[model samples]
Target: DMTQAASTGGMMEMPRASRGQAHLKLAEFAAKQLRGETRVASFSLNGWDTHSRQKRNLGAALERLSGCILALKQGVGPAVWDKTAVVAMTEFGRTVRENGTGGTDHGTGGTMVLAGGAIRGGRVYGRWPGLEEATLYNRRDLMPTGDVREVCAWIMRGITGTGISDLETKVFPGMQMAQDPGFLR
Candidate 1:
């Protein structure tokens, strides 16, 4: 089964390094989904802890993430890809200003990336808080304009057909999913 999945998922063509291997494994799972062998798959890529020289560090991390996404799409094919939703998130945000080491410290607001054909692709969703000193949270971090939990709740509602009440009470307690952001297609 591993051999069949590897061949079908193009795992042999992937790199042998650990990071690349994670992507290759995700692709294998995606291919299994295509064959009705799985319904959900998830993988994690590390190296986001850029405490110094963030430009170089973050760029490399993004590149790896990009490769992973591309591999998943290719493994699933267009038809299945259209039904998939890829959500990439981090636990914390970075400061708006660069640190002495040219990196950023943890801050109040961060970003979430949603991909695949299932999402409404073109536009950025969330209100932008200007970077002006008056606008920044504590004059250091981007002011969070919306609750991330609400956005996530909406995405879950759309994907799982779960009722808003259940999403509010069960999934994310005290989260008032104000309006449907219409993240799904």
Candidate 2:
């Protein structure tokens, strides 16, 4: 996809390729199986490395991301959309400090976004770690107090009826499941 094309074009043509192709491909695959209820779908679009021209790269990434979401919504029918859920995330985030070339370097603490009618929409979850001295990780990156494993546990229990004990003992050893508050509608 976009990454492939962008790479072939030496980085300038990445955003030129359509990001919505992934969603369309998924719909095609689902249709072949005659599936009635598709529960989940995940996708990732890269090119966030803004070593130069940060604004342009960010804009293109946002546009492509938006297109992908819209296409996915249209591909999946309304009935399924009402029950389905989409969760997007990145491995990590970049540093707060802009580099000399108006770019960002690898850092800690990325963001996760959830979308769909099943989600409570119009609400941002998670605690915001204020950007300040003594708050950064190793005095350079954002501190991650929230363990992602706990979030995964909640989703497994609530969505698929996985037992908390099993998740704690098997999936993530020694993880204490806390109150997830039913993120799904």
Candidate topping lDDT: 1
Candidate 1 lDDT score relative to the true structure = 0.77
Per-candidate local distance difference test = 0.77, 0.64
Give per-residue CA lDDT, model 2, range 35-96, as digits (tens). 23334433467667777778779788766666666666666657666765566666777777
Judged by whole-model lDDT over C-alpha atoms, candidate 2 comes out at: 0.64
In model 2, where is the ten-residue run with the lowest total lDDT? 4-13
In candidate 1, the residue pairs with backbone N, CA or C atoms under 3 Å apart (3 or more residues apart, or in different chains) clash, namely: none
lDDT of 1 at 139: 92
Candidate 2: TM-score?
0.75
TM-score of each: 0.83, 0.75
Q: After superposition, how far is residue 120 of candidate 2 from its true place, in Å?
A: 1.3
Q: Residue 185's C-alpha lDDT in candidate 1? A: 98
